[model samples]
Each structure stands twice: as structure tokens, then as C-alpha cells.
Target: MMRLFIGGAVLVALAGCGETRDGNKPTGEATAKAAPAGWNAMDACATVGTPAVAAAMGKAVTGTALDPVSQPDGLRAGFSMCTFTLADGAKLTVLTREAADGDAYDAAVAAARKIGEEFGSPAVDVAGIGKAAMWTARPAALQVFLDDRRYATISLFGADFMPDGSEAARSAATAIARKLAS
Candidate 1:
């Protein structure tokens, strides 16, 4: 009887061990939980920036829902701002904000342009309309803007980037720009 009880307890423990824990593998549900479904890495960044700039501006620029990473150099400070998804399986990182004091903005812009140029993307595959852009080392894209009045420049860096819903990003930018203007 004693041997049978011990054997039964061991069997119960083994049975529980084989059970799958929540999110054991990269299944549809697990992937969905890991990241937003139907969304790529770039889309993750693009969807950042809130619509309520008028209210939120001037107080304090708090952190955002989308996780932001900052890379600061002597001449320029780059921030991964927007994130979005692409048709292809690539995660995009939208880098924005290159702040400087005097000629820092210009230097930042030059650095950014140089970085993009160095990417040396082959002929842009999209309809091959314009010159073939250079592809960055990582799967990424960039949108750069200079704010002369604010003396700050911003770059939208994308990873696994796509042009989906650019209008949405533009609208978000408008709000952010307005805030920055003030």
C-alpha cells in the first residue's frame, strides 16, 4: 500500500509537468500577447504621440505608452519615437528628436543625412519612381525635419518600416509640432 501511494504521487507530479504553461511557444495567441496582432515593429513606433497636445504641452513631456529608447551623441541626441508594422516581417524603429544648441541642429541633420546616405539603399523598389534610396544597415526608414524656430530637428526613424497610415503619423506630428512651437 505504501509503495502504491508513493508511485501515485510521482505520477501526478509528472502529469502536471507536461502541461503547457501560458505562452509556451510562438503560437498565434502567444505572438499576439507578445506583440499587437497584425502589427510589425515599425508600426509600433508610428502609433506613438498623443492627440492631446494642447493640454499636455508646456507642463512636462512625460513618458509615452510606446517604449522609447534614447541614443545621445556629442553632436546629436537620437530618440526612437514611433513604431509601426510592415507587410513583411520586420520591426521598425522610428527615431525622432535631434536636439542641439547652436550649430548642433545642422550637425545633427548632417549626421542623419550621412547615416541615411551610408545606408545606400538600392533602387527603391516602390514603383521605381524616384532614385533608388539606400537601405540602412538595419531594416529601417527615416523622416527628417528641421525646426529652425525651435532650434531643434526631429527624425522619424523606422525599423521594419512601412508607409502605412502616414497621415496618422503626420497628424500626430502636427500636434507634437504645435506643442514644440509653444
Candidate 2:
């Protein structure tokens, strides 16, 4: 599939980014390591470049895997994920990106909602995280809108976690978002 090829290419391009997730998330602050220039598939892992994932999930992170993200037609449009493998064999995936334009962001949100609909998803609005945000149960992800041109999503697998009702998770995620958008 074209998607696969595009993803492969993106990885190859990103592989050149010699940076690794070596920084610590300041104590009591759930901030991501800001990728110096901007967001991309390469630095997407930086979104979780904090201990927030571990703290919120109650498990230590052991490894990470990145899923390729792109806009329609396989364009690598600032979309990517950092799926952290926890000590308990769980996954905490963070897909956060700041699109180049507003239209792209709006389109991405629509696409996410459409996919979530398949599982009889009901969106629950979330406050204090972004410009406007919501959570869809079926897909089990929190869509955080940074503005008209950017957004982020956090999803934990093999762990029953939701940031909406939990103060700890919400605070951590909010801090991460703030660090990402900075």
C-alpha cells in the first residue's frame, strides 16, 4: 500500500535524527521535550519525553515504538505517535502533532471522529487541556486541540486509563500538551 511506503520513507528520513529521549520531566511537571525546531515523525517520541507516562500509568516505561502518521494521500503532515511499552507490558501511546495549517487540523479531527464512530463512540467533552478537547470512549483516546492548527491525542492500551475523570492523569496530560505547544 502507498501508506506503508510513505511511512517507511518517513522513518528513513527520521532515522537521521540522532536525538534520543534522555531528558527528565521536571518533578511535578508533565511536560514533553520540545523538539527544537518543530514536530515530526522523528521527534514525535519527544511528546512522551517525560516521566508523566510512567507516573500516570503507574508503571515504568521500558521501550517505545512509533506509528507513522500522515494526512490524506500519504503526506507526512506532522502526525506521529510514541507508543511506550510499560514495565507491566502495557502500552501508552501519544499521538500529538501541530499541523501546518488550520484546514489540515480540522480535517484530521473529523477523520478521528469518523473512525471512533465504528465502536459506537460517544464523545465526552474535556476541559482545561486545550483550546477545546473531547474524549471518545470506543477509541479510548483524548483529543486535545491546541488551537485551530494543532492537536494531540493520548491513548493507553492494556491499562484502563482515562484522563478526564482522573485528576493525576489530566494534570499530567495538560502539562505535556502545554510543553508540546510551547
Candidate 3:
């Protein structure tokens, strides 16, 4: 399961490198939208280290410095990320993406779906996390599309990891989703 999960995540990350599965380029209009009104792209750093997330992990987690995403097109796309490392060297990454409108949001969802399909594990809808939420067990990742024209992905990685059904990752992701929604 861990191997499948890791493989799925790898496929997802690689899919982000270029055009969609249909070979269509993402239009500028879709990627040009701003983040929700109050969202600062930089806040992703703090979100990863929230007290709620620490509690869910059952251990103190230290966040790494914020890393700016550099896309090949140089479009900002309101993307930011940071990783929280646990005492056992396990890591969880928090990813924030701008989805100011339905077009952007839909595109993002499609991309996620394609990634899941590529890994032979299609995304399954998850209830109550956001406007729309999905989880791919093999990768043990959770993705939430909040009401604020923003979306987030929580990915788990480490030598010691929990199964997808475990509450730890889901709980932490939910806690972060609540923060993002607010």
C-alpha cells in the first residue's frame, strides 16, 4: 500500500509538469485568477504548523522554510508549499493553489483526477472536509476544495506511515482544511 501510495503521488507530481492528459494546454485565463480575497499565499507555511495538526500527529512537528513554486510558464498561479517534519523524519506537505473561479477550480479537479487515474487509483469523494474533498488511499493524500476559491492538498511521507484509513492523516488534513476555510 505504501508503495502504491508513493507511486500515485509521484505520478501526480509528474503530471503537473506539463499539459493535461488530453494534450491541451491550460489557458492563461484559467491559471491567471487570484487567490480568494483574504488568502495570502504565504500563509501555507503557518497552516502546516498549526497546533491542531501537531495534535493530530501525536507529536511535535517542525515546518520547513516556505518554498515558492516556479512553474515553467512563470505564471504565479498563487501556488505555495511547505513541509512539516515529525520527530521520526516523517513529513507532510501542505500545498495551496489559487482557484479564484469555477474554471480554475474545475481545471484543478480534472488535473487531480487525471493523476489518480494515472496511478490506477481514482480519487474517491470524501465528505465534510470542504466544498469538495477527495482522497487517494494508495498515496495516502487528501485534497480539499474550500469555499474560498482556494484548494489544498495534504500528503504524507516517511519511513513510518499510517494507512489511508487511519485518522491521523485525515484528522490533520481536516484541521488544516478548517483553517483554510476560515
lDDT order, best first, reads: 3, 2, 1
Which residue segments of model 1 deviate by more than 4 Å? 1-65, 69-80, 86-90, 98-102, 122-140, 149-182
User: What is the lDDT, from 0 to 100, of the residue 104 in candidate 3?
Assistant: 46
Number of the top lDDT candidate: 3
At residue 131, candidate 2 shows an lDDT of 67
Q: Compared with the true structure, what per-residue lDDT tens digits does model 3 show for residues 1-182?
A: 44335434533543333233344544323434444455664566765455756776777776574665533233223566767777777877777665323344555566776655655667888777667888765466777776435567777776444543455666666667766766
User: Could you tell which candidate, 1 or 3, scores higher by lDDT?
Assistant: 3
Q: Candidate 2, overall lDDT?
A: 0.53
lDDT of 2 at 55: 66
lDDT (0 to 1) per candidate: 0.30, 0.53, 0.59
Q: Write candidate 1's Cα lDDT for 51-154 as tens digits.
A: 34223222223333343444434333333344333333222223333322222333333443454344353211121111111122211332323241011112
- Residue-level error in angstroms, candidate 1, position 52: 14
Q: Find the candidate with the highest TM-score and give its number.
A: 3
